[model samples]
Target: MEYRPYKPVNLTAAGRDYAVAMVRRHRLLETFLVTTLGYSWDQVHDEADRLEHAASQTLIERIDALLGHPDRDPHGDPIPTVEGHTHRPAHAIRLADAAPDIYRIARVSDADPARLNRFSGHGLRPGQTVRVGEREAGELTISLPGNDQAPLVLAPEETKAIWVSPAASAGLRGPASI
Candidate 1:
């Protein structure tokens, strides 16, 4: 696609392409940050967001190869395909409505840094199994895979942002499992 600036003349087609490419890189980088580098889910977005626009295609490819071609980022957002296409599955669910038990957190909205931090503090991460213990009007109390005490509570907004997969019996692990 020919690059065209979205609004202000300060933007150029090259700049637009760069921006799109950066966004793509950022999502892929998030996957690497959490899975390979041991970065907390909350810690990767800002750094990746900054680097995405600046990184070379070569660099991004290297990271992608290292991460084994992850399809989703740390927040469960889709990573853009190399050709710039994004394939996102529609599986979002509210934490408040989820049954009280173990399930896999598939994705979360990364728009709020503070919310992401709160999720990480409570041990919520993509692919990790979590047990919902209680549900209030606007919040869900959850237990991490290995933790005994429940320290994670998702507010209505946060709960709405999180996407989960139904937990299979084989995937249940109590606190200390992760």
Candidate 2:
């Protein structure tokens, strides 16, 4: 049997834009899943990723409205604007490098399933305050509010996936009623 290399699809500018728009929709849907539907942090990413490409713009808009125009997704990723504009925060650090103080989770990488799964187990969600307790080698031990008994330890790879801002970190200390 002759072997043939699979050729990847070439995406034009329009196609790229469509792809970004679809990603934006999926991120928004993931936010809804975590905030409204009560889906686990680890469970929503794949579901939203699949749905984002399939859902219509009208349906996405409705979901966005239902989610109350959220700015960030479940994993702290930015939700793309309806106009496709994305406003990202300036400072983002790995949980390992983060100082031992309250800080807000800004963004998280969506490429790694294992990392996301680990974060979910630690209760590390966007808009949640994380305090870095200690760093040993490339691993970080951090604590979340209301979870002081066991500090969550994360590797550098896992920490790099999470972005955060100090100013917004203050918000995580308050009630979750937002």
Runs in model 1 lying further than 4 Å from the true structure:
1-20, 33-39, 85-90, 97-101, 168-178
Q: Write the per-residue lDDT of candidate 2 for residues 1-178, one digit (tens) a residue.
A: 2234796667777777787788788888888887888887778878887887788889888998988887777767777787777777777766556776667777777777777777777776667677666778878887777775687777777777887676453444433522
Q: List the residue pairs that clash in candidate 2.
A: 104-169
Report the C-alpha lDDT of model 1 over 1-178, residue by residue, as the tens digit: 3345684355467776666677778888777777888987778888787787777879889999998887888787777777777765455465657877667887778888888887777767677777777776767777675577746776778888787765653254544344
Candidate 1 overall lDDT versus native: 0.73
Query: After TM-score superposition, what is the CA distance of residue 89 in candidate 2 from its true location, in Å?
Result: 1.7
Best by TM-score: 2
* Displacement of the residue 66 alpha carbon in candidate 1, Å: 2.2
